[model samples]
Target chain A: MEALVALSIAVLTASGVWLLLRPRTFQVIIGLSLLSYAVNLFIFSMGRLRSNAAPLLEKGVQADPAALADPLPQALVLTAIVISFATTALFLVVLLAARGLSGTDHVDGGEGRQ
Target chain B: MSFLADHLIITPILLPLLAGAAMLLVNDRHYRLRAALGLVSTLALLVIAIMLVQLADVPAGDASLGRAYLLGNWPIPVAIVLVVDRLSALMLTLSAVLALCMQIYALARWHRAGLHFHSLVQFLLMGLNGAFLTGDLFNLFVFFEVLLAASYSLVLHGAGQQRVEAGLKYIAINLAASLLFLIGVSMIYGVTGTLNMADLAMRLPDIAAADRPLLEVGAAILAVAFLVKAAIWPLGLWLPNTYGAASAPVAAMFVIMSKVGIYAVLRVWMLVFGPHAGASAYFGGDWLLYAGLATVTVAAIAVLATQDSKQLAGHSLLVSSGTLLAAIGTGQAGVVGAALFYLISSSLGIGAFYLLIELTERNKTAGADILAVTWEAFGEADDVLPGEEEVGVAIPATMALLGISFILCALLIAGLPPVSGFIAKFALLTAAFNPEGLGATGEPISTTGWLLLAALLLSGLTALIALARAGMKIFWMPASTRVPRVRLIEMAPIGTLLILCMVLTVQAGPVLRYTQAAAEELFAPESYVESVFGAPRAGELPQEAEL
Candidate 1:
C-alpha cells in the first residue's frame, strides 16, 4: 500500500514540476495544486502501511492493538492540506491581479516590457 | 478557567488570529484605531510569552497543568500538541515586539496604501506566533504559509511597478520553496509514521540502522526548504530583489521572517537529528558551517557592491542570517547566543534602513545610491541613475535620523564596539575559541578561530570604507533639494524602535544569558519530552525530533 501511494506521489510530483515549467502564472498555480495533492497523499501514507483496522477502538470489540493506523500523520496531513489550500487561493488571486494590472502572466510580471 | 492558563501555548497564536478576523469589520483608515488594536494584541502576546517563560522555570507538573497541552486531551503522538518553553517563548516575544513596532512604523503608509493593513499585519503576526509555538512540523509548515501569504500581498500593497515585478519573483520562488517543503515533510513522515515533532523525537532513535540514510536524506531535503526561506547562499538570489523592491515597513517586518528558518534548523537539528547531529556521513554539520560561512562572505561582498540603501540593508540581513546559521552549525551555546542576539539587533537595524529609504526618497544622491545597490546586486545591466528630478522629495528629520540609523546599523553589522553588533560577534568569537566544543568535537581550533577573526576584521573595514563612504555622500554631501517636513506619525515609531535597539545594546548581558538559557532549553529534550509525555517510564526511550 505504501509503495503504491508513494509511486502515485512520485508521478504526480513529476507532472507537477513539468507543469510548473510552463510560461504562465496560472498554470504554475495549477502545478502547485497538483504538487500539494501529491504531498498530502504522501504524508498520509506515512503511517507505515497499516490496514485491517481503523484507529478508533470500540467498546467490547477485540482487535489487534498494533494493527490500527498511526493517527498522527493523518492529523498532520489534514492541517497541511487546509493551509496549502488557503495559500493556493491567495496566490491565485494575487497572480490574477498582477496579470490584470501588468498585462502579462510571465513571472517578473513586467518582464521585457520594463 | 485555570485550564486557560495551562493552555497558554495556544493564546499567543490565537490572539492575533482572532484579531485578524475581527479587523475585517474595521472600515476606516484610522491609524490610531489600528495601532491601538495591534498594540493591545501584541502586548497580550508578550504577557503570555512571559507567563510561558515563568512556567519553564517551574518544575514540570509538580502542579495541575501539563507543559504541552494536547488539543482536546487526545493524548501524545495523536492529538496536535502546543509546546512552550524558554526558546519558543523568547522567540514569540521577539517576533511580537518587532511586529508591533513595524505596525506602528507603517502608519503613514497605512493611510497612503490602505487595504486592511491592520488585518494583514495582524494575520502576519498570527503566522509568526504560530510558527514559533507549534510543536508539530506540519503545523510549522502551515504557519509558514500563513506568514508568506500575508507577506505576499503586503509586498505589493503600494502597487508600484517595481513592487509588482519584484513581488512576482518573490511569490514564484516561495511557491517553489513551499513545494519542496511539502515533499520534504511527506518523506519524513513516510518513514517515521508520525508528524508530531515531540512524538517523532521519541521514535527517531528506534529507526532501523539501514533506514537511517533515508531519514537523513529526508532531513537534508527539508533543510533546503528552510535555507531557501532563510535566504542562505545561492538560494537567496531572490531575497535582496524582493526586499529592496518592497515597501519600507513591509521590508522591516520581513527581517524576522528568515530568522524563522534559522530557528527551525536549530530546533530540528537538536531535537530530530539528536545531539550528535549528522553524525552519519550523509548529514554533515560541517557542510552547514561551510555553507553558512560562504553565505556570509557572498552577502558581504554583495552588500559592498550594492548601492541601493534598501538592497544594501537587504544584503546585510542575508549576511546576518548566515551568521546565525553558522553559529548553529558550530554547535556551541555561546555561538548560538551571539547569533540569537544578532537576530534582535539586525532585525531592528534593518527596520531603520527601510525607514531611511522612505524618508530619503527626495534626496537624489541617497535615492540614486539606494538604487545602485540593487543594480549591482541583481547584475542589472544599467548603472545610470534616473533624472535628478526623479529623486524623492526627501524629509530633513527623516534624512538625519536615517543617516544616524545607517551608521549605527553599519557599526552593528561591522561588530564595532559600543553597539549590540559588537556584543553579538563577541559572543560568537568566544564560543568558537572556547575549549569545550573544539576539544570535544576533535575539530581543528585554528581554522574556526581565524575564520571568526577575519570575518570580524573585514566587517569593520567594510563599515569604515563602504558605509562611511556612502554616509559621507548622503549626510554631508548636502542635498541639492530640501526634503518635506517629516510627519510626527512617522517619527514616533522610528524613534521608538531605534530607542529600543539602544536599550537592547545596553542590556546585552542579560540578553546573552537569556539566549543561553533558551539554547540550553533547546538542547535538553528531556524538558520538552517531560512537558509533553508527562513522566518518563522505566526503560522508556528518550524523545527524538520527528524525522
Candidate 2:
C-alpha cells in the first residue's frame, strides 16, 4: 500500500511539473490541479495509511491514539483541497481573461511569440 | 482593559476577518459605508496592536504571565495556540500601520477602480495578522493561502492588460509554491507526529536517528517554499514584474508579504533548529546565507537596470529581504536585532516609495510605457530620443514635497547617513566584527560574513546610483512636464510613512533596545516554548506515551 501511494504521488508530480513547464496557459492550469491533487494525497497519507480505524472516539471512552487514524492530517488535507479548488477556479477565470485581452493562450501573453 | 488585553492576540486576526466578511455583504456601490467600516476596523486594530506590544513587553520576571492563549482550551500541543511574544506583537503593529496607511491611500482613488477592493485589503490583513500570531504550522499554511488568495484578487483589482498578464504568472508561481508548502508540511508532520511549532521543537531532539534524514529533507523542502515567497534568487524572478504591475496601494501592502516568508524562516528556523535539535542544528544556515547573497546581487543589478520607479521599488524589496535572510543566517542575536531594525526602516521606505511612484508618473504621458517596452526589447533605449520637450511649466508645491520624500526614500534604501538605515547597517557591522557578540561559541566571522558586508555596501552604492539617476530624470531632467496634481489625502500617507521612518531615526536608541530584546527572546526559544506550553507541562512527556 505504501509503495503504491508513493508511486502514484511520484507520477502525478512528474506529470504536473512537465505540464507546468509548457507554454500554454491551459496546460499550466491543468498542471496546477494535478499538482494540488498529488499534494492532497500526500497530506492524506501523512496519517500513516490507517484502515478500518475510527477518527473519533465514543463519549466516555478513553482514546487509544495508536488504534485510531490521525484526524488532524485529514482535516488539513480537507482544508487544502478546498483552497486548491477555489484557487483553480480563480486561475481559470484569469486564464480566460488573459486570452481575451492578449488574444493568445500563451503564459507570457504572447510577448515573445510575436 | 484587562479583558481586552487577555484577548488582544486574537483581535488582530479576528477584527479584520469579521470586518472583511461584513464588508462583503455591503453593496459594492456603497463605497462610503465600506470605507467607514474599513477605517474604523483598521484604527481599532492599530490600537489593539499597540496594546499587544505593551502586553508582550511585560517585565521579563513576569513574562510567564498573561501571554499565550490556547484556543478552545485544549491543553498545550493539542490545541491551536496564539502567542503574543515581543516579535509577533512587533510584526502585528508594523503590519497594522502599513495596512492603515495603504487603505487610506487607496481610498483616494484605487478603491473605486474595482469591486471589493476594501474587502480584499481587509482580508489580506486578516491573513497577515493570523500568520504572525498562529502557533501551529497548518494554521500558518491556511493563513498563507488566505492572504495569497486575497493578493491574487487585489493584484488584478485595476484589471488592466498588463495587470492581467502579470497576475497570471504571479498566481501560477505562488500556487506552485503553496503546493510545495503543503508537501513539506505534511512530510514534517508525518515524521514528527505534530504540527504545533513549539511542540515540534520539543520533539525534534528525541526523534530516532533513523528518521533524522527524512526530517531534514522535509525541513529543506519547507525552506524552499518559504524562500520562494521571500523572493530569494532564481525563485524570485516573478516579483519585479508582478509588483510593478500592481496598483500603487496594493504594491505598498505587498511590501509586508515577502517579509512574512522571512519571518517564517526566522521564527521556525530559530525555534526548532537553533542550538537545539541535537543532530539538526544549523540545518540550512549556509544555503540561506549564500542564496541570500545571490539574491542581493541580482536585486542590486536589477536596481541599476530598472527604468521605472515601481520596478525599482520592487527590486529594493528583494534587496531588503536578502539582507534580512543573510543576517538571520548569521545566527548572531545582535545582527538579527539590527536587521530587524533595518527591516522596519527599509519596508516603510520602500512602501512609501511605491506609493510615490504613481503620483510621480501621473503627469507623464504614454512615453513612460513606450520607454519601458523599448528597454525590455532592446536592453537600453539610448537610440530613443527624450520624447518631445515642452516649455517649462511652473513647478507646483507638491513637487518639492515629493522631491524631499524621494530623497529621504533614496537615502533610506541606499543605507546612507542620517537615517535609520545607516544606524541599522552600522549596528549589524559592529556586531559582526565583535567576536564576543557572535553567540557563546565565539566563532570568528567566516567568509560568508565578509561577503555579506561587501554585498551590503555594493548594493547600497548601486541603490544610490539607481535612485539618483531615476530621481534626476523624473524631478529635474523633465524640462516641461506638468506637475502631478497630488491631493492632500495622498500626500498625507506618504508623509506619515516618512515621518515614521524619521521617528525610527530619532528614537533609534529605544527602538534598537526593543528589537534587541525581541531578538534575544527569539534566540532563547526555551522561554517561548515554556510560555506557550506553560512551565510545568513543558518537559512532561507522559501524555505523549499515552498518545
Winning candidate number (lDDT): 2
lDDT string for model 2 (B299-372, tens) is 99999998877888999999999999989888888888888999999889999999998777666654565345
Report clash pairs, candidate 2.
none
Off by over 4 Å in 2: A61-64, A111-114, B368-396, B438-445, B535-547
**What are the candidates' interface root-mean-square deviations?**
4.2, 1.7
User: lDDT of candidate 2?
Assistant: 0.86
The fraction of reference A/B contacts recovered in model 1 reads 0.56
Q: lDDT tens string, model 1, B78-182?
A: 666777776777778777777776776665544346466777888888888888877888778888888998899888766655667777778877877876777
Q: What is the TM-score of chain A alone in each candidate?
A: 0.85, 0.93
lDDT tens digits, residues A7-78, model 2?
A: 999999999999999999999999999999999999999889978998897666778778888888899988
